[model samples]
Target: MAAASGTRPEHMAPAEVFYDGTEAKKYTSSSRIIDVQAQMAHRCIELMALPPGHRCFILDIGCGSGLSGEALSSAGHAWVGTDISADMLTVGLARGTPGDTLLSDMGQGLPFRTGSFDGAISVSAVQWLCYATQKSHQPYRRIRAFFASLYRCLKRGARAALQIYPENAAHLEMLSAAAAKAGFRGGLVVDFPNSTKAKKYYLCLVAGSGERDDSAAAATSAAGAAAGAAADSSSSSASDGDLKHSDAAMEATDGMGSAMTSSGLVVAMGRRSSSDFEKRRRSRAQDRVGAHAPARKEWVLRKKEQRRAKGLPTRSDSKYTGRRRPDRIT
Candidate 1:
């Protein structure tokens, strides 16, 4: 199916109504979309701070057709997925996936017992809960219920990464505020904050502790320092290693600014600052300096070249091409 133009249905209806039979099938089968969801799920789990050990049970909320759960399964982690659409779950079950699947509306709350999973992940799911299509459905009340239930479902100190696509800053605030009211002590982590297509926001939540947020920042700083140290070490090595090491260091610093670490801290992501925009404006200004004003003769020649390229009639370039002709001598 072709993507919708101008307007998105996701912004309007409840997920269950929007993701019916063919829509669910098409969503599950689209390779491009599948890859995107997989990448997002990987990032979401990574932000969860799950330990690197034996397989741990994870919750995949709004796991449309088990796409996100597939990512968890590939990583050797066991997952139980829940979605509002029976059609989506049907598609997931048809795949013979390893993870258990549930048919449930996230706004109503998850069905699991308290401390049921090691960690939880939801990709492109939570924000849907922000809309209320029916009078019976209250956005704030529903979000609070889901977050509180999710908070109780995870083991203490276990983080939940909810990848959300808020329509605007207000929607984001609504979701975050609901989570906070539900006793979740973490904040939103935005990846690639300056880019439009590549940006992602994960609502990282800690079940019982407030210090996880600080710990996340500390972890990011430490990772950056380690990367910096390695670059310095590589500088002392062979000349060829310096370039590679410096690149690695720069990448580490970039990642540090991107999001949280794996099982480390629950740091909130920062937005692009005014200074960043100023730097970009300065670079753009520098690039355009002397670009607008061209030598009169050179300007005529360049315009002539452009016209010729377009196969348009062009005046022959001459010193007098753009100047008034001198008065004819008597």
Candidate 2:
């Protein structure tokens, strides 16, 4: 719709299919999405460098309910949101083209021409990307290609920033490597607070000059070397302290971006589970981070799952790990 897609539904839309009714999806009433948008907008205000009424061309890669668009408008900028889901786009369009909302996937290669936007911001998107050049959900390779496209799409110095939540070093490593190949300059990967109780996350970002994208390249190279160093440093230390310490090297990011079709915008009641909390785990471990305060919810969920599996009291009485076998996520 609106010059994004001709008629077919590509995979770049941001609205999830199961939640189109919009009663109880995670991001429907979930305020965390807004929290991140607020933070993203703050960054955009500085990064875009646009004056009032400048009519800056903007793209919200995975624009869900148009939260990013709302934030951008508040900052005095025009916006164009494109997603794959008709339902989600419906939600986005309801806000009326505060700018221009379209339906297109970043993976399919941004439908817009080169230098079409002054800035691009992707919030909790990108990390969920899996489509690769070979097809069949090659998430990592697709991520790399997406970045490379960004480099060609923007002008020399346009700002292309993304915030990802990496589950561990592996996540960050993949992003670092791809961003470099994709042609980003320097990016700041920082530390943040997280807790098992509340499920807090950290942001790993790749931000800098689109002109040279040196920082992104450096990040990729450094990450490669670091991976080598970590592997060489201690292949023998399997102890708890060593293994835990291994994760210490993983940092949060402040920026990142990409595209996807819409899915999961609205949902039937009772479809969400506590596990949804960790859906972005890999991405978080790779980018976005929030307050890290220990909470007991994780342990509680673990106990509930155990109890449910054993056909015991639905209520758990002790601390546990929310870990679920991959087969059980559905």
Candidate 3:
């Protein structure tokens, strides 16, 4: 749809130009659009994998008219929504959604502190970040900045599900690459992957610095180190195996580029869960399982406890606990 009487949709309008005044009113009052937004937002929240009855702080990006926020609010989630259109936020205020709303361009990056939000959901909003309405607006940089900022602000182990409408394979890859580079672990999960009309592309993301990811990384690193050690120890097939392992890791990234075929865009009507993510994750973890360090001997812990009971100092309960022994170590 055109932003103004003669505006072309290809040259997308700024959020204010397209969603303010009459446009905002029309959108807020439209039953069809509202329903669609509600459904998509609900799906995005589901993809976040929050436990049932769990109330969390959520971020609603491109929260036009607060339709998406309404769903989150109804679910008893506290949210802070942002949009580039003040008119939309005004409508949201009128509706009395249970959350704060801000007029801000997401392309410039979110303003929340690191680890501020438990999760994030953007319904029909991320795609807008792909369009540059101003001369200074570079889509790649903007998208990267937004995802990078988002990655930092989410709590460890938190997920974000972005429901985006990419114009083409190139656009989709562009967004996915940026997310991956920003250290997200999940991928483009297409709900109803076989149905063109019903298919939804959800960029499901888990913060890469989370404990799960750290363990995965440590596993992969251990695998590589073990492979190196084997290569040095044996002068037979081990060397070839190490070369194959390195080659496979390098080859894995080849498909991350803009190599998706046009036919690949035609999603059929079939909903599939993100099982592949789990599969690959487990595979990586298994690859290094054999190299896992042996558990610490029980005697080490026993001795530490013995020393503590005798009023001697031992390492704090945890690395960060820093609970020093009382005065004389007792």
Stretches of model 3 off by over 4 angstroms after superposition: 1-10, 209-330
Pairs that clash in candidate 1: 49-263, 216-265, 216-266
Ranking by TM-score: 1, 3, 2
Query: Model 3, residue 61: what's the lDDT?
Result: 89
Clash totals in order:
3, 65, 6
Best prediction by TM-score = 1
lDDT, candidate 2, 1-330, per-residue tens: 221222211133323443254522344444654565565545444434443467677777777667777878877777777665566667656646476777765665677767767767776556555323233656775676677776666666566545444444455557666766665544432212121111112222333354434443444334334323443343232111111112322222212221110121111111246677677675566443323313345556766788899988685444334323254564
Candidate 2 weakest lDDT stretch, 10 residues: 259-268
Candidate with top lDDT is 1
User: Whole-model lDDT, candidate 3?
Assistant: 0.67
Which consecutive 10 residues in model 3 have the weakest lDDT in total? 237-246
Residue 104 in model 3: lDDT:
85
| Rank order (by lDDT, best first) | 1, 3, 2
lDDT, candidate 3, 28-122, per-residue tens: 88776677688778767766767578789999988877899989988889999999888888888888767888888888899989999988999
* 1 against 2, candidate with superior lDDT: 1
* Predicted candidate 1 versus true structure: per-residue lDDT over 137-176, tens digit per residue: 8888998899889988988777888877666566667777
Against the unseen true structure, what C-alpha lDDT does each candidate score? 0.69, 0.49, 0.67
